[model samples]
Target chain A: MSLCEAEKTFILHGVEENFRIDGREREDYRPMEVEIGIISHAFGSARLRLANTDVLVAVKIEVDTPYPEKPSQGKLDFFVDCSANATPDFEGRGGEDLATGISNSLSDAYRSSKAFDLKKLCIMKGQKCWKLLVDILLLECGGNLYDAVSLAVKAALWNTRVPGVKSVGIDGKNVELNVSERLNDCVPLDVSGAPVMVTVCKIGEYCVVDPSAAEEKCSSAALVVAVSQGNITTVLQGSAGSLHPTTLMDSLGLGVEVANQLNIALMETLQSAPPHFDVGFLK
Target chain B: MSRKELLSKIGLRADGRRAQELRRIRCKLGVFTEPDGSAYIEQGLTKVLAAVYGPHQVRGGRSKAQYDAAIVNCQFSMAVFSTGERKRRPRGDRKSTEMSIHLKQALMATIKTELYPWSQIDVYVEVLHADGGVYAACVNASTLALIDAGIPLKEYVCACTASLANNDIPMVDISYQEEVLGGPTLTVAALPMSEKIVLMEMTQRFHLDHLPKVLKEALRGCKDIKVILDEAVRNHLVNVGSSSGWVKNK
Candidate 1:
């Protein structure tokens, strides 16, 4: 992703004009394509392609006893896998740092009870709980993984169809569950407040949104802000360089403003998604 | 795990496929914009994506360059959510290492290595979902990616799985259900036109008497898969060639 001097100048001038090299406005997000239920075997699955950045998210549920500290609530675990297909550098354990960072932020974003409720996932108090593992695999690294992964996570959650429970019978110490009748019934997960992360990269005294590979190279530092329903969930300042508190605040404000529009488009995109639409790499 | 339980009384497998039938295959090439060649394939529930880069000078070390052939480097990784339970890591695992080695061996046999002497070609494959036939899918995917990269090949390298079921019947392209139920799973990667087996891995044991039929079924499955892959390649080339204005000039 090396940038020549001329190419760097062109991008800098474009940023000064508030128009990115891709012709996107400061608050505009690249066109994103999303598909749900692409993976049949997984309980819930979605694939999101934002320009060239591609992400696939799957939700797998398992029954387990709740933690003693949180007996009544269920569990939400986020796992991110950066595959080598994205780049040759991520062949071995090289992508662990990026994966761990993304997963941890997702965990924190969903920790808020308003964003994702874990209580409804409990099958029984203290005894049985549905542990949902939201696994995200980064297939491509065109750019902006946080946004792509977050949007795909929200879509996968929406597409999730929790199995219907028929009835439960508890006898002396034995519990017999009868769940055969409501096989077709399903419950969609609540994801209205799902957070979407927007990254603001500081390049040459100016801040830009959705910086591509070349732009990222010139930028010495960046900040990632996760916004949920107009509120800032978390802010992650990244790069080998440092950011002052004032610059951090400025980036957070920009992330918030851009994320509001980003969230609206994401919600609309998911809502207006065409069912039976062919979703794959060709498009 | 009994011999009779390998297949049902109705002559159907655990996933209800006939002994000679193969799972459905769906694939798309050029899935990404950055890679020189990329493809995504689904054989039943097993989904794999492969990206090819090179025919250029080797990266990392030049000492590994071949004198009169291209150095083929391959990496095979499966997503943590690819299996029934989430995996702790994607690569460096025993199964993944074996898969990578098998992929490189099969691809090296098919690619025209002499044309790019002292250069390197990289084929990276990621398995998004693993139900069964992972090895076969990865081989097929890498073949398509190589084709997408415009790298010449001796022939289409195809792979398939075979299993012995119900003592007499042989199953082609065994699914996850059939794979775990019982019997032997024989995986073969072959250059379809040359009918040369590049790599063959067999798991479990079946009587020597059943070997012929099961091996034949697997070969038949490989040939079938070759047909599908060949058609895809032709269509893709046509689309790419025409869209590039070559036909207009002609």
Candidate 2:
């Protein structure tokens, strides 16, 4: 994944001409395969393979008291574990910092009401609510991790079916809730507004989406844009290097445009697809 | 006290398996393109992913590198959500550390270390789901990935788990249900072609007299798995050769 000056120039020239090494255009996304319910033990699970970047997302829901500030809203915790399987560099706790960073960003991006509505998860005010733990494991890192993770998480939530409550019984200090026997009576999560984060790296003169590991090395600064239903959720300026104000603004504009197009394509693919049985890793 | 008692009146063991049966094994190789070698294997409900990346130069301190042997580094981690209950951390636990060491031991035995003297071979195994026999699944998957990376090996390293159901009938491929039923579980990792057992582990006490039968059942299972894996490798090579226009007229 090392990118020298010569290699960077070759990529830049290819991007300028609207063609990539894999014969993809500037806006073209690599072929992706999404499968749900791979981890049978979890309530909801999905794995997405966007080229070489493989992301596995599993959602585990448990009943717990709601937050003091947001009494009616449920909890959504995100954890990104960069497994050593991804690379030798991520061995031990080496990847902890990056994993934490990705998890925190995901939490923030999905916190806003414009993105994901957390209120529906509340079962009974502050007493009883569902806590959805979205655990993301990074299996490989070819590049474009943000896109792959988001897609997998979204798909996992989509396939998640929450158990139905038939009745609630408050007996003394203990409260019991009844459920239906038919599993089909469960409710699925509404993910129409789930934000999809796209990492747009500013390499050399032009900005690019879905940068491979080599392109990422050459890039000075990057922008992470979270788009939900064509509306921008959050835009975070990243990268250790600096970016001019004008270039930053330009990057933001392109980010939103590309995010919108990405969403449309994503929705079209998810909606028209059949039930995916070939889970990730297994594929 | 007989086969009927071992299988019970329902004709099923503690985990509901026939005495001479194996757990369902679902596997895939080259699951990731970034890694030089990667594979995912699910034996029954236990799921493990093994990745291999090297034959390349050894990183870090040069003093550790041997002039005549390739260093094999292994790390084993299980997902927090993998078990029945949540785990505190993925690795660094006592069980994970032990598993990691055992993995290194198993892989090193098969990989031809002498071929790449000063180079380091890294094998990382992650357990996504834990039913039982985590080490065995990891070892098998790692073997597939190493072959996928085109690394030379003395023989295919296959692993399997066995447990004495009702103290006599040896059940091949133990599952979570069997493990929880308080039986004598034995796991073995071996080079099947060489008939050499590289690693052998057992949890709980077992009768010395019944050990031989259990070990024999496990080895049979390992040999069966090795055959399947060999066939898969051959099929994969054929597919790649035909697609790359290297299809030879047979």
**TM-score of each candidate?**
0.92, 0.94
Name the top DockQ candidate. 2
Give me the displacement of residue B25 in model 1, in angstroms.
Answer: 2.4
Name the lDDT value of residue B211 in candidate 1: 87
TM-score of chain B of each: 0.94, 0.94
lDDT of 1 by residue, A152-242 (tens): 9988998887776666677876555555466467677888888888889887778888877677777768988888888888888766788
For every candidate, give the share of true A-B contacts it also has: 0.63, 0.79
Q: Spell out the clash pairs found in candidate 1.
A: none
Per-residue CA lDDT of model 1 for B130-199, tens digit only, reads 9889999999999999888889999999999998876778889978767777678999998877778899
lDDT of each: 0.84, 0.84
Candidate 2 positional error at A40, Å = 2.0
- Model 1 accuracy (lDDT, Cα): 0.84
Q: Give me the TM-scores for chain A across all models, comma-separated.
A: 0.92, 0.94
lDDT of 2 by residue, A1-283 (tens): 6667788888878878888767877767778877778788888888888877888888888888899989999889998899999989999999999898888878878988768888998887767788898899998888888878888888888878888778767787666767677878888989889988888887667788888877677777888988888777878776798888998888878888887887777777778877756555654
Candidate 2 CAPRI classification by DockQ: medium
